[model samples]
Target: MISSISTNQIKYVLALEKTGSFSEAADLCFVTQSTLSIMIKKLENQCNLILFDRKSKPITLTKEGEELINQLKLIYQEFEVLQEIIQGTNQEFYGNLRIGIIPTLAPFLLPLFLNKLVTNYPNINFSIDEITTQEITKRIKTRELDIGILSLPIEDQELIQTSLFNESFLIYDASGTFSRNKKYKIKDIDVSRLWLLEESHCLSSQIEKICLLKKMDTSKHNLEFKSGSILSLLELVNMNKGLTLLPKLATLQKNLIKPSYIFNLVNPIPAREIGIITHPNFSKKRLLDILEIEIKKSVKPLLDKTKRIQLINPY
Candidate 1:
Protein backbone atom coordinates (compact mmCIF):
# COMPACT_ATOMS: atom_id res chain seq x y z
CA MET A 1 0.00 0.00 0.00
CA ILE A 2 1.20 3.53 -0.79
CA SER A 3 2.00 5.47 2.34
CA SER A 4 0.89 9.06 2.80
CA ILE A 5 3.45 11.90 2.42
CA SER A 6 5.55 12.41 5.55
CA THR A 7 6.04 15.77 7.30
CA ASN A 8 9.83 15.39 6.96
CA GLN A 9 9.53 15.21 3.16
CA ILE A 10 7.23 18.23 3.22
CA LYS A 11 9.72 20.05 5.48
CA TYR A 12 12.52 19.23 3.05
CA VAL A 13 10.65 20.89 0.22
CA LEU A 14 10.02 24.01 2.38
CA ALA A 15 13.69 24.18 3.34
CA LEU A 16 14.67 23.97 -0.33
CA GLU A 17 12.33 26.85 -1.10
CA LYS A 18 14.04 28.93 1.59
CA THR A 19 17.66 28.03 0.90
CA GLY A 20 17.32 27.93 -2.95
CA SER A 21 20.03 25.25 -3.10
CA PHE A 22 19.91 21.61 -2.02
CA SER A 23 23.29 21.78 -0.27
CA GLU A 24 22.16 24.76 1.82
CA ALA A 25 18.77 23.21 2.55
CA ALA A 26 20.55 20.10 3.85
CA ASP A 27 22.75 22.21 6.13
CA LEU A 28 19.69 23.91 7.62
CA CYS A 29 17.99 20.56 8.20
CA PHE A 30 21.20 19.07 9.63
CA VAL A 31 21.27 16.39 6.97
CA THR A 32 23.66 15.49 4.14
CA GLN A 33 23.11 17.19 0.76
CA SER A 34 22.37 13.87 -0.97
CA THR A 35 19.80 12.91 1.70
CA LEU A 36 17.87 16.15 1.20
CA SER A 37 17.99 15.77 -2.59
CA ILE A 38 16.83 12.12 -2.38
CA MET A 39 13.91 13.02 -0.13
CA ILE A 40 12.79 15.78 -2.52
CA LYS A 41 13.08 13.38 -5.47
CA LYS A 42 11.00 10.88 -3.54
CA LEU A 43 8.32 13.49 -2.92
CA GLU A 44 8.33 14.38 -6.62
CA ASN A 45 8.03 10.69 -7.57
CA GLN A 46 5.14 10.12 -5.21
CA CYS A 47 3.30 13.10 -6.66
CA ASN A 48 4.40 12.22 -10.19
CA LEU A 49 5.60 15.77 -10.85
CA ILE A 50 8.97 17.44 -11.16
CA LEU A 51 9.11 19.76 -8.18
CA PHE A 52 12.36 21.52 -9.15
CA ASP A 53 13.78 22.46 -12.51
CA ARG A 54 16.96 20.35 -12.49
CA LYS A 55 18.46 22.27 -15.44
CA SER A 56 18.41 25.55 -13.50
CA LYS A 57 21.63 26.15 -11.53
CA PRO A 58 20.17 27.90 -8.47
CA ILE A 59 17.08 25.62 -8.68
CA THR A 60 13.66 27.13 -9.16
CA LEU A 61 10.31 25.50 -8.47
CA THR A 62 8.28 24.35 -11.45
CA LYS A 63 4.74 25.70 -11.77
CA GLU A 64 3.39 22.57 -10.06
CA GLY A 65 6.07 22.86 -7.36
CA GLU A 66 5.04 26.45 -6.72
CA GLU A 67 1.48 25.32 -6.16
CA LEU A 68 2.66 22.42 -4.00
CA ILE A 69 4.76 24.79 -1.90
CA ASN A 70 1.71 26.90 -1.13
CA GLN A 71 -0.20 23.81 -0.05
CA LEU A 72 2.77 22.77 2.06
CA LYS A 73 2.67 26.10 3.88
CA LEU A 74 -0.96 25.54 4.81
CA ILE A 75 -0.26 21.99 5.83
CA TYR A 76 2.69 23.03 7.97
CA GLN A 77 0.66 25.68 9.71
CA GLU A 78 -2.02 23.16 10.53
CA PHE A 79 0.58 20.71 11.77
CA GLU A 80 2.03 23.28 14.16
CA VAL A 81 -1.42 24.12 15.49
CA LEU A 82 -2.31 20.51 16.01
CA GLN A 83 0.96 19.83 17.78
CA GLU A 84 0.38 22.87 19.97
CA ILE A 85 -3.05 21.61 20.98
CA ILE A 86 -1.71 18.20 21.92
CA GLN A 87 1.15 19.67 23.91
CA GLY A 88 -0.92 22.34 25.61
CA THR A 89 -3.78 20.16 26.84
CA ASN A 90 -1.78 19.16 29.94
CA GLN A 91 0.02 22.50 30.28
CA GLU A 92 -0.55 26.25 30.44
CA PHE A 93 -1.58 28.38 27.46
CA TYR A 94 1.92 27.43 26.39
CA GLY A 95 2.06 27.87 22.64
CA ASN A 96 2.63 30.56 20.08
CA LEU A 97 -0.45 32.62 19.43
CA ARG A 98 -0.04 34.21 16.03
CA ILE A 99 -1.96 37.46 15.93
CA GLY A 100 -2.41 40.35 13.49
CA ILE A 101 -3.10 43.91 14.64
CA ILE A 102 -3.78 46.82 12.34
CA PRO A 103 -1.18 49.62 12.26
CA THR A 104 -3.63 52.14 13.69
CA LEU A 105 -4.23 50.19 16.90
CA ALA A 106 -0.81 48.62 17.51
CA PRO A 107 1.09 51.42 19.20
CA PHE A 108 -1.29 52.69 21.87
CA LEU A 109 -3.21 49.48 22.42
CA LEU A 110 -0.28 47.08 22.71
CA PRO A 111 1.62 49.23 25.16
CA LEU A 112 -1.28 49.23 27.58
CA PHE A 113 -1.85 45.47 27.47
CA LEU A 114 1.35 43.66 26.39
CA ASN A 115 3.30 43.99 29.64
CA LYS A 116 0.61 42.49 31.84
CA LEU A 117 -0.22 39.88 29.26
CA VAL A 118 3.38 38.66 29.15
CA THR A 119 3.77 38.71 32.92
CA ASN A 120 0.48 36.93 33.56
CA TYR A 121 0.76 34.29 30.92
CA PRO A 122 4.38 33.49 30.30
CA ASN A 123 3.52 30.31 28.46
CA ILE A 124 1.33 32.05 25.93
CA ASN A 125 3.99 33.13 23.44
CA PHE A 126 3.13 35.74 20.83
CA SER A 127 4.00 36.02 17.16
CA ILE A 128 2.49 39.33 16.22
CA ASP A 129 2.33 40.90 12.75
CA GLU A 130 1.36 44.55 12.37
CA ILE A 131 -0.47 44.72 9.07
CA THR A 132 -3.23 46.65 7.33
CA THR A 133 -6.89 46.05 8.21
CA GLN A 134 -7.50 44.15 4.98
CA GLU A 135 -4.53 41.87 5.60
CA ILE A 136 -5.59 41.24 9.23
CA THR A 137 -9.07 40.20 8.06
CA LYS A 138 -7.58 37.93 5.40
CA ARG A 139 -5.20 36.30 7.89
CA ILE A 140 -7.98 35.63 10.41
CA LYS A 141 -10.17 34.11 7.67
CA THR A 142 -7.39 31.82 6.45
CA ARG A 143 -6.41 30.68 10.00
CA GLU A 144 -2.95 32.13 9.46
CA LEU A 145 -3.55 34.17 12.62
CA ASP A 146 -5.05 32.95 15.89
CA ILE A 147 -6.71 36.30 16.54
CA GLY A 148 -6.97 39.86 15.25
CA ILE A 149 -7.53 43.21 16.97
CA LEU A 150 -9.24 45.77 14.73
CA SER A 151 -12.11 48.18 14.36
CA LEU A 152 -15.63 46.89 13.85
CA PRO A 153 -17.71 46.30 10.65
CA ILE A 154 -15.58 43.35 9.54
CA GLU A 155 -18.13 42.11 6.98
CA ASP A 156 -16.94 38.51 6.75
CA GLN A 157 -19.77 36.24 7.84
CA GLU A 158 -17.56 33.25 8.62
CA LEU A 159 -15.43 34.97 11.28
CA ILE A 160 -16.51 35.87 14.82
CA GLN A 161 -15.92 39.26 16.49
CA THR A 162 -15.79 39.91 20.21
CA SER A 163 -16.09 43.59 20.99
CA LEU A 164 -13.57 44.80 23.55
CA PHE A 165 -14.41 48.51 23.95
CA ASN A 166 -14.85 51.70 22.02
CA GLU A 167 -12.11 54.33 21.87
CA SER A 168 -13.53 57.79 21.11
CA PHE A 169 -11.71 60.26 18.86
CA LEU A 170 -11.16 63.74 20.29
CA ILE A 171 -10.28 66.62 18.02
CA TYR A 172 -6.75 68.09 18.38
CA ASP A 173 -6.32 71.75 17.46
CA ALA A 174 -2.97 72.82 18.96
CA SER A 175 -2.65 76.14 17.16
CA GLY A 176 -6.24 77.06 18.17
CA THR A 177 -7.19 77.01 14.48
CA PHE A 178 -10.46 75.18 15.14
CA SER A 179 -13.02 77.27 17.05
CA ARG A 180 -13.41 76.25 20.68
CA ASN A 181 -16.90 74.85 20.49
CA LYS A 182 -18.24 72.24 22.92
CA LYS A 183 -19.91 70.46 20.01
CA TYR A 184 -18.72 70.52 16.40
CA LYS A 185 -20.06 69.10 13.16
CA ILE A 186 -18.25 68.08 10.00
CA LYS A 187 -19.14 71.29 8.15
CA ASP A 188 -17.96 73.56 11.01
CA ILE A 189 -14.29 72.67 10.50
CA ASP A 190 -12.19 73.74 7.54
CA VAL A 191 -11.45 70.57 5.56
CA SER A 192 -8.28 72.12 4.12
CA ARG A 193 -6.74 72.69 7.56
CA LEU A 194 -7.62 69.25 8.97
CA TRP A 195 -4.64 66.91 9.30
CA LEU A 196 -5.42 63.22 8.94
CA LEU A 197 -3.50 59.99 8.80
CA GLU A 198 -2.94 58.60 5.31
CA GLU A 199 -5.09 55.87 3.83
CA SER A 200 -4.66 52.15 4.76
CA HIS A 201 -5.08 53.05 8.45
CA CYS A 202 -8.53 51.96 9.70
CA LEU A 203 -8.70 55.20 11.72
CA SER A 204 -8.69 57.13 8.47
CA SER A 205 -11.71 55.11 7.38
CA GLN A 206 -13.49 55.73 10.68
CA ILE A 207 -12.70 59.46 10.56
CA GLU A 208 -13.89 59.62 6.96
CA LYS A 209 -17.19 58.07 7.99
CA ILE A 210 -17.73 60.55 10.84
CA CYS A 211 -16.62 63.84 9.20
CA LEU A 212 -18.04 63.06 5.74
CA LEU A 213 -14.59 63.91 4.34
CA LYS A 214 -15.24 61.37 1.62
CA LYS A 215 -14.27 63.60 -1.30
CA MET A 216 -13.24 66.75 0.54
CA ASP A 217 -9.97 68.28 -0.49
CA THR A 218 -7.30 68.44 2.24
CA SER A 219 -4.11 70.53 2.45
CA LYS A 220 -0.73 69.12 1.38
CA HIS A 221 0.56 70.60 4.64
CA ASN A 222 -1.26 67.72 6.37
CA LEU A 223 1.58 65.28 6.77
CA GLU A 224 0.93 61.74 5.52
CA PHE A 225 1.64 59.59 8.55
CA LYS A 226 1.36 55.79 8.26
CA SER A 227 0.55 55.07 11.93
CA GLY A 228 -2.54 56.10 13.92
CA SER A 229 -0.65 56.63 17.18
CA ILE A 230 -1.72 60.33 16.98
CA LEU A 231 0.81 61.24 19.72
CA SER A 232 3.51 62.54 17.38
CA LEU A 233 0.86 63.80 14.96
CA LEU A 234 -0.74 65.80 17.77
CA GLU A 235 2.69 67.22 18.62
CA LEU A 236 3.07 68.28 14.99
CA VAL A 237 -0.38 69.88 15.06
CA ASN A 238 0.64 71.77 18.20
CA MET A 239 3.87 72.98 16.60
CA ASN A 240 2.54 73.66 13.07
CA LYS A 241 -0.95 75.05 13.85
CA GLY A 242 -3.18 72.36 12.27
CA LEU A 243 -5.83 69.97 13.56
CA THR A 244 -5.93 66.13 13.64
CA LEU A 245 -8.02 63.46 15.36
CA LEU A 246 -6.82 61.79 18.57
CA PRO A 247 -7.96 58.48 19.93
CA LYS A 248 -8.55 58.66 23.70
CA LEU A 249 -5.75 56.18 24.40
CA ALA A 250 -3.10 58.12 22.44
CA THR A 251 -3.81 61.36 24.29
CA LEU A 252 -3.67 59.65 27.68
CA GLN A 253 -0.18 58.19 27.22
CA LYS A 254 3.05 59.94 28.51
CA ASN A 255 2.71 63.44 26.88
CA LEU A 256 -0.08 65.94 26.13
CA ILE A 257 0.18 68.00 29.33
CA LYS A 258 -0.98 71.26 27.65
CA PRO A 259 -4.37 72.87 28.20
CA SER A 260 -6.38 72.37 24.98
CA TYR A 261 -10.14 72.72 24.74
CA ILE A 262 -11.74 69.39 23.77
CA PHE A 263 -14.94 69.34 21.71
CA ASN A 264 -17.50 66.62 21.25
CA LEU A 265 -19.04 65.68 17.92
CA VAL A 266 -22.77 66.37 17.75
CA ASN A 267 -25.26 63.47 17.84
CA PRO A 268 -23.42 60.35 16.69
CA ILE A 269 -19.97 61.04 18.10
CA PRO A 270 -16.99 59.63 16.12
CA ALA A 271 -15.66 56.43 17.69
CA ARG A 272 -13.87 53.29 16.62
CA GLU A 273 -15.13 49.98 17.96
CA ILE A 274 -12.15 48.08 19.31
CA GLY A 275 -12.57 44.30 19.25
CA ILE A 276 -10.86 40.94 19.08
CA ILE A 277 -11.64 38.60 16.18
CA THR A 278 -11.17 34.88 15.90
CA HIS A 279 -12.30 32.01 13.70
CA PRO A 280 -15.24 29.85 14.79
CA ASN A 281 -13.06 26.75 15.00
CA PHE A 282 -10.63 28.24 17.51
CA SER A 283 -11.04 26.18 20.74
CA LYS A 284 -9.12 28.20 23.32
CA LYS A 285 -12.14 29.72 24.97
CA ARG A 286 -10.84 29.94 28.56
CA LEU A 287 -7.59 31.56 27.46
CA LEU A 288 -9.31 34.12 25.23
CA ASP A 289 -11.71 35.02 28.05
CA ILE A 290 -8.82 35.71 30.40
CA LEU A 291 -7.16 37.85 27.74
CA GLU A 292 -10.34 39.90 27.30
CA ILE A 293 -10.55 40.43 31.05
CA GLU A 294 -6.97 41.62 31.20
CA ILE A 295 -7.47 44.04 28.31
CA LYS A 296 -10.49 45.65 29.97
CA LYS A 297 -8.61 46.12 33.23
CA SER A 298 -5.63 47.69 31.53
CA VAL A 299 -7.74 50.04 29.39
CA LYS A 300 -10.06 51.51 32.04
CA PRO A 301 -7.73 53.85 34.01
CA LEU A 302 -6.29 55.46 30.86
CA LEU A 303 -9.57 56.91 29.53
CA ASP A 304 -10.30 60.63 29.99
CA LYS A 305 -13.49 61.91 31.69
CA THR A 306 -14.95 63.19 28.40
CA LYS A 307 -14.01 60.04 26.55
CA ARG A 308 -15.73 58.05 29.28
CA ILE A 309 -18.84 60.29 29.14
CA GLN A 310 -19.79 59.06 25.70
CA LEU A 311 -19.19 55.39 26.05
CA ILE A 312 -19.23 53.72 22.63
CA ASN A 313 -20.70 50.37 23.60
CA PRO A 314 -19.35 47.53 21.53
CA TYR A 315 -21.59 45.47 19.28
Candidate 2:
Protein backbone atom coordinates (compact mmCIF):
# COMPACT_ATOMS: atom_id res chain seq x y z
CA MET A 1 0.00 0.00 0.00
CA ILE A 2 1.28 3.51 -0.80
CA SER A 3 1.98 5.70 2.23
CA SER A 4 -0.48 8.60 2.33
CA ILE A 5 1.08 12.09 2.78
CA SER A 6 -0.62 14.43 5.26
CA THR A 7 -2.17 17.61 3.84
CA ASN A 8 -0.81 19.54 6.85
CA GLN A 9 2.70 18.37 5.92
CA ILE A 10 2.22 19.68 2.39
CA LYS A 11 0.99 23.00 3.82
CA TYR A 12 4.08 23.23 6.06
CA VAL A 13 6.38 22.67 3.09
CA LEU A 14 4.60 25.42 1.16
CA ALA A 15 4.80 27.81 4.12
CA LEU A 16 8.50 27.12 4.57
CA GLU A 17 9.12 27.75 0.87
CA LYS A 18 7.22 31.00 1.04
CA THR A 19 8.98 32.41 4.14
CA GLY A 20 12.36 30.66 3.73
CA SER A 21 12.57 30.31 7.54
CA PHE A 22 11.74 27.40 9.82
CA SER A 23 10.42 29.46 12.73
CA GLU A 24 8.40 31.84 10.55
CA ALA A 25 6.96 28.95 8.58
CA ALA A 26 6.13 27.17 11.82
CA ASP A 27 4.42 30.36 13.14
CA LEU A 28 2.43 30.59 9.90
CA CYS A 29 1.34 26.94 10.32
CA PHE A 30 0.49 27.56 14.00
CA VAL A 31 3.04 25.01 15.24
CA THR A 32 6.42 24.85 16.98
CA GLN A 33 9.60 24.78 14.82
CA SER A 34 10.47 21.31 16.14
CA THR A 35 6.96 20.10 15.27
CA LEU A 36 7.23 21.51 11.75
CA SER A 37 10.76 20.06 11.45
CA ILE A 38 9.47 16.62 12.47
CA MET A 39 6.64 16.90 9.91
CA ILE A 40 9.17 17.78 7.16
CA LYS A 41 11.44 14.88 8.21
CA LYS A 42 8.46 12.50 8.19
CA LEU A 43 7.45 13.77 4.72
CA GLU A 44 11.04 13.25 3.48
CA ASN A 45 11.07 9.68 4.83
CA GLN A 46 7.74 8.92 3.20
CA CYS A 47 8.75 10.48 -0.15
CA ASN A 48 12.44 9.38 0.00
CA LEU A 49 13.82 12.88 -0.66
CA ILE A 50 15.89 15.54 1.16
CA LEU A 51 13.50 18.52 1.09
CA PHE A 52 15.54 21.36 2.58
CA ASP A 53 19.08 22.57 3.48
CA ARG A 54 18.77 23.17 7.22
CA LYS A 55 22.49 24.24 7.42
CA SER A 56 21.81 27.31 5.27
CA LYS A 57 20.81 30.42 7.22
CA PRO A 58 17.08 31.11 6.62
CA ILE A 59 16.80 27.57 5.14
CA THR A 60 16.81 27.02 1.40
CA LEU A 61 15.09 24.27 -0.58
CA THR A 62 17.45 21.73 -2.15
CA LYS A 63 17.36 21.08 -5.91
CA GLU A 64 15.21 17.98 -5.36
CA GLY A 65 13.14 19.96 -2.85
CA GLU A 66 12.44 22.67 -5.47
CA GLU A 67 11.13 19.99 -7.85
CA LEU A 68 8.99 18.50 -5.07
CA ILE A 69 7.66 21.93 -4.07
CA ASN A 70 6.55 22.59 -7.63
CA GLN A 71 4.78 19.24 -7.67
CA LEU A 72 3.31 19.98 -4.25
CA LYS A 73 1.89 23.29 -5.50
CA LEU A 74 0.12 21.48 -8.32
CA ILE A 75 -1.11 18.79 -5.93
CA TYR A 76 -2.32 21.37 -3.40
CA GLN A 77 -4.11 23.36 -6.09
CA GLU A 78 -5.79 20.17 -7.32
CA PHE A 79 -6.72 19.32 -3.73
CA GLU A 80 -8.22 22.81 -3.39
CA VAL A 81 -10.13 22.26 -6.63
CA LEU A 82 -11.63 19.08 -5.18
CA GLN A 83 -12.61 20.90 -1.99
CA GLU A 84 -14.20 23.69 -4.04
CA ILE A 85 -16.11 21.18 -6.15
CA ILE A 86 -17.49 19.47 -3.07
CA GLN A 87 -18.35 22.78 -1.39
CA GLY A 88 -19.99 24.04 -4.58
CA THR A 89 -22.13 20.91 -4.77
CA ASN A 90 -23.05 21.24 -1.10
CA GLN A 91 -23.85 25.01 -1.56
CA GLU A 92 -21.35 25.83 1.18
CA PHE A 93 -20.04 29.37 0.71
CA TYR A 94 -17.45 29.38 3.49
CA GLY A 95 -14.04 30.02 1.91
CA ASN A 96 -11.97 33.09 1.23
CA LEU A 97 -12.65 34.58 -2.20
CA ARG A 98 -9.44 36.31 -3.32
CA ILE A 99 -10.64 38.81 -5.92
CA GLY A 100 -8.71 41.25 -8.11
CA ILE A 101 -10.35 44.29 -9.75
CA ILE A 102 -8.85 46.63 -12.30
CA PRO A 103 -8.52 50.22 -11.06
CA THR A 104 -10.61 51.81 -13.85
CA LEU A 105 -13.68 49.76 -12.91
CA ALA A 106 -13.00 49.17 -9.21
CA PRO A 107 -14.03 52.64 -7.98
CA PHE A 108 -17.36 52.64 -9.83
CA LEU A 109 -18.32 48.95 -9.88
CA LEU A 110 -17.27 47.83 -6.39
CA PRO A 111 -19.38 50.42 -4.57
CA LEU A 112 -22.48 49.12 -6.35
CA PHE A 113 -22.58 45.63 -4.79
CA LEU A 114 -19.54 44.84 -2.61
CA ASN A 115 -21.43 45.71 0.55
CA LYS A 116 -24.38 43.63 -0.56
CA LEU A 117 -22.17 40.56 -1.04
CA VAL A 118 -20.78 40.90 2.48
CA THR A 119 -24.28 41.32 3.90
CA ASN A 120 -25.81 38.45 1.94
CA TYR A 121 -23.03 35.87 2.12
CA PRO A 122 -21.83 36.37 5.67
CA ASN A 123 -20.14 32.98 5.61
CA ILE A 124 -17.92 33.94 2.67
CA ASN A 125 -14.76 35.98 3.33
CA PHE A 126 -13.29 38.46 0.87
CA SER A 127 -9.73 39.57 0.13
CA ILE A 128 -10.24 42.28 -2.45
CA ASP A 129 -7.15 43.72 -4.16
CA GLU A 130 -7.20 46.82 -6.34
CA ILE A 131 -4.79 45.86 -9.10
CA THR A 132 -3.94 46.67 -12.69
CA THR A 133 -5.34 44.48 -15.53
CA GLN A 134 -1.94 42.95 -16.31
CA GLU A 135 -1.35 42.09 -12.66
CA ILE A 136 -4.78 40.51 -12.26
CA THR A 137 -4.39 38.51 -15.48
CA LYS A 138 -1.09 37.08 -14.20
CA ARG A 139 -2.57 36.50 -10.72
CA ILE A 140 -5.57 34.61 -12.14
CA LYS A 141 -3.27 32.31 -14.11
CA THR A 142 -1.10 31.55 -11.04
CA ARG A 143 -4.25 30.86 -8.91
CA GLU A 144 -3.28 33.75 -6.59
CA LEU A 145 -6.70 35.20 -7.21
CA ASP A 146 -9.96 33.25 -7.32
CA ILE A 147 -11.60 35.78 -9.67
CA GLY A 148 -10.70 38.89 -11.70
CA ILE A 149 -13.14 41.63 -12.60
CA LEU A 150 -11.55 43.05 -15.74
CA SER A 151 -12.26 44.13 -19.34
CA LEU A 152 -13.24 41.02 -21.26
CA PRO A 153 -12.04 38.86 -24.16
CA ILE A 154 -8.55 38.46 -22.66
CA GLU A 155 -6.43 36.48 -25.16
CA ASP A 156 -5.25 34.04 -22.48
CA GLN A 157 -6.37 30.46 -23.15
CA GLU A 158 -5.95 29.43 -19.51
CA LEU A 159 -8.62 31.85 -18.27
CA ILE A 160 -12.38 31.16 -18.47
CA GLN A 161 -14.19 34.50 -18.79
CA THR A 162 -17.92 34.97 -18.10
CA SER A 163 -19.79 37.91 -19.63
CA LEU A 164 -21.09 40.30 -17.01
CA PHE A 165 -22.34 43.46 -18.76
CA ASN A 166 -21.56 45.94 -21.50
CA GLU A 167 -20.33 49.31 -20.27
CA SER A 168 -20.69 52.24 -22.67
CA PHE A 169 -17.99 54.92 -22.83
CA LEU A 170 -18.90 58.58 -22.52
CA ILE A 171 -16.60 61.31 -23.81
CA TYR A 172 -15.82 63.88 -21.12
CA ASP A 173 -14.95 67.12 -22.89
CA ALA A 174 -14.20 70.18 -20.76
CA SER A 175 -13.42 72.46 -23.75
CA GLY A 176 -16.92 71.90 -25.26
CA THR A 177 -15.46 71.67 -28.80
CA PHE A 178 -17.82 68.72 -29.18
CA SER A 179 -21.53 69.54 -28.68
CA ARG A 180 -23.44 68.09 -25.72
CA ASN A 181 -25.64 65.01 -26.42
CA LYS A 182 -23.92 64.76 -29.80
CA LYS A 183 -22.51 61.47 -31.10
CA TYR A 184 -18.77 61.81 -31.83
CA LYS A 185 -16.75 59.54 -34.05
CA ILE A 186 -13.30 58.11 -33.17
CA LYS A 187 -11.71 60.17 -35.98
CA ASP A 188 -13.19 63.34 -34.42
CA ILE A 189 -10.97 63.00 -31.31
CA ASP A 190 -8.21 65.60 -31.08
CA VAL A 191 -5.45 63.24 -29.92
CA SER A 192 -3.23 66.20 -28.99
CA ARG A 193 -5.89 67.54 -26.63
CA LEU A 194 -6.91 64.13 -25.24
CA TRP A 195 -6.10 63.11 -21.66
CA LEU A 196 -5.62 59.40 -21.05
CA LEU A 197 -5.05 57.06 -18.14
CA GLU A 198 -1.46 55.70 -17.87
CA GLU A 199 -0.12 52.77 -19.93
CA SER A 200 -0.49 50.31 -17.02
CA HIS A 201 -4.29 50.63 -17.12
CA CYS A 202 -6.23 48.39 -19.53
CA LEU A 203 -8.77 51.17 -20.06
CA SER A 204 -5.94 53.27 -21.53
CA SER A 205 -5.35 50.59 -24.14
CA GLN A 206 -9.07 50.35 -24.87
CA ILE A 207 -9.35 54.10 -25.25
CA GLU A 208 -6.21 54.15 -27.39
CA LYS A 209 -7.76 51.58 -29.75
CA ILE A 210 -11.21 53.22 -29.78
CA CYS A 211 -9.78 56.68 -30.50
CA LEU A 212 -6.88 55.51 -32.70
CA LEU A 213 -4.63 57.64 -30.47
CA LYS A 214 -1.02 57.19 -31.52
CA LYS A 215 2.05 59.20 -30.61
CA MET A 216 0.80 62.78 -30.66
CA ASP A 217 2.83 65.98 -31.26
CA THR A 218 3.31 67.45 -27.76
CA SER A 219 3.53 71.03 -29.15
CA LYS A 220 -0.31 71.22 -29.22
CA HIS A 221 -0.79 70.01 -25.60
CA ASN A 222 2.44 71.03 -23.67
CA LEU A 223 2.72 68.66 -20.63
CA GLU A 224 2.43 64.85 -20.75
CA PHE A 225 0.53 63.48 -17.75
CA LYS A 226 -0.46 59.80 -17.94
CA SER A 227 -2.86 59.43 -15.03
CA GLY A 228 -3.39 56.09 -13.21
CA SER A 229 -6.93 56.79 -11.99
CA ILE A 230 -10.07 57.83 -13.87
CA LEU A 231 -10.62 60.60 -11.31
CA SER A 232 -7.07 61.79 -11.94
CA LEU A 233 -7.67 61.65 -15.70
CA LEU A 234 -10.78 63.78 -15.27
CA GLU A 235 -8.81 66.37 -13.31
CA LEU A 236 -6.09 66.42 -15.98
CA VAL A 237 -8.68 66.99 -18.74
CA ASN A 238 -10.37 69.73 -16.72
CA MET A 239 -7.10 71.52 -16.06
CA ASN A 240 -5.71 71.02 -19.58
CA LYS A 241 -9.02 71.96 -21.28
CA GLY A 242 -9.00 68.54 -23.01
CA LEU A 243 -11.22 65.46 -23.52
CA THR A 244 -11.28 61.79 -22.39
CA LEU A 245 -13.44 58.67 -22.75
CA LEU A 246 -15.14 57.59 -19.53
CA PRO A 247 -17.47 54.72 -18.67
CA LYS A 248 -21.15 55.55 -18.02
CA LEU A 249 -21.04 54.14 -14.48
CA ALA A 250 -18.05 56.40 -13.68
CA THR A 251 -19.97 59.52 -14.72
CA LEU A 252 -22.56 59.11 -11.96
CA GLN A 253 -23.92 62.27 -10.22
CA LYS A 254 -21.74 61.69 -7.16
CA ASN A 255 -18.61 61.96 -9.28
CA LEU A 256 -19.48 65.67 -10.06
CA ILE A 257 -18.01 65.45 -13.60
CA LYS A 258 -21.16 67.05 -15.19
CA PRO A 259 -23.44 65.00 -17.52
CA SER A 260 -23.54 67.87 -20.07
CA TYR A 261 -19.83 67.34 -20.69
CA ILE A 262 -20.41 63.66 -21.53
CA PHE A 263 -21.00 62.56 -25.18
CA ASN A 264 -21.70 59.15 -26.77
CA LEU A 265 -19.77 57.84 -29.77
CA VAL A 266 -21.67 57.70 -33.03
CA ASN A 267 -21.06 55.92 -36.41
CA PRO A 268 -19.71 53.03 -34.29
CA ILE A 269 -20.62 53.72 -30.66
CA PRO A 270 -17.64 52.34 -28.75
CA ALA A 271 -18.12 50.41 -25.50
CA ARG A 272 -16.21 47.71 -23.61
CA GLU A 273 -17.63 44.34 -22.56
CA ILE A 274 -16.83 43.94 -18.85
CA GLY A 275 -16.70 40.41 -17.46
CA ILE A 276 -15.67 38.20 -14.54
CA ILE A 277 -12.47 36.27 -15.36
CA THR A 278 -11.26 33.12 -13.59
CA HIS A 279 -8.68 30.40 -14.00
CA PRO A 280 -9.85 27.26 -15.82
CA ASN A 281 -9.04 25.28 -12.66
CA PHE A 282 -11.19 27.52 -10.44
CA SER A 283 -14.37 25.79 -9.18
CA LYS A 284 -16.09 28.27 -6.86
CA LYS A 285 -19.25 28.35 -8.95
CA ARG A 286 -21.53 29.34 -6.08
CA LEU A 287 -19.35 32.29 -5.04
CA LEU A 288 -18.70 33.28 -8.66
CA ASP A 289 -22.41 33.17 -9.51
CA ILE A 290 -23.42 35.24 -6.51
CA LEU A 291 -20.78 37.92 -7.18
CA GLU A 292 -21.72 38.06 -10.88
CA ILE A 293 -25.42 38.32 -10.01
CA GLU A 294 -24.91 41.08 -7.46
CA ILE A 295 -22.79 43.15 -9.87
CA LYS A 296 -25.34 42.77 -12.70
CA LYS A 297 -28.28 43.56 -10.40
CA SER A 298 -26.67 46.81 -9.27
CA VAL A 299 -25.30 48.07 -12.62
CA LYS A 300 -27.91 46.72 -15.09
CA PRO A 301 -30.45 49.51 -14.69
CA LEU A 302 -27.82 52.20 -15.16
CA LEU A 303 -25.88 50.61 -18.04
CA ASP A 304 -28.47 48.80 -20.13
CA LYS A 305 -26.62 48.04 -23.40
CA THR A 306 -30.02 47.06 -24.88
CA LYS A 307 -29.95 50.65 -26.10
CA ARG A 308 -27.76 51.80 -29.01
CA ILE A 309 -24.12 51.06 -28.01
CA GLN A 310 -21.16 49.89 -30.12
CA LEU A 311 -18.37 47.82 -28.62
CA ILE A 312 -14.65 48.24 -29.43
CA ASN A 313 -12.25 45.33 -28.92
CA PRO A 314 -9.30 46.51 -26.79
CA TYR A 315 -7.35 43.31 -27.25
Winner by TM-score? 2
Error of 1 at 53 (Å): 90
Error of 2 at 198 (Å): 0.7
lDDT of 2 by residue, 90-178 (tens): 54667789999988888889988999888766777888999987889999888999999988888887789898998888788999798
Best by lDDT: 2
Assess the local accuracy of residue 173 in candidate 2 as a C-alpha lDDT between 0 and 100. Answer: 90
Candidate 2 clashes between residue pairs 3 or more apart in a chain or in different chains: none
What lDDT does each candidate get?
A: 0.74, 0.83
TM-score for each prediction? Answer: 0.62, 0.68
| Model 2 RMSD, rounded to 1 decimal | 18.3
Off by over 4 Å in 1: 1-91, 178-181, 219-232, 256-262, 304-315
**Tens digits of per-residue lDDT for model 1, 134-236:** 8888887788988888877588778889988777777766666556545676566655666666566767666665566564354466455544545666666
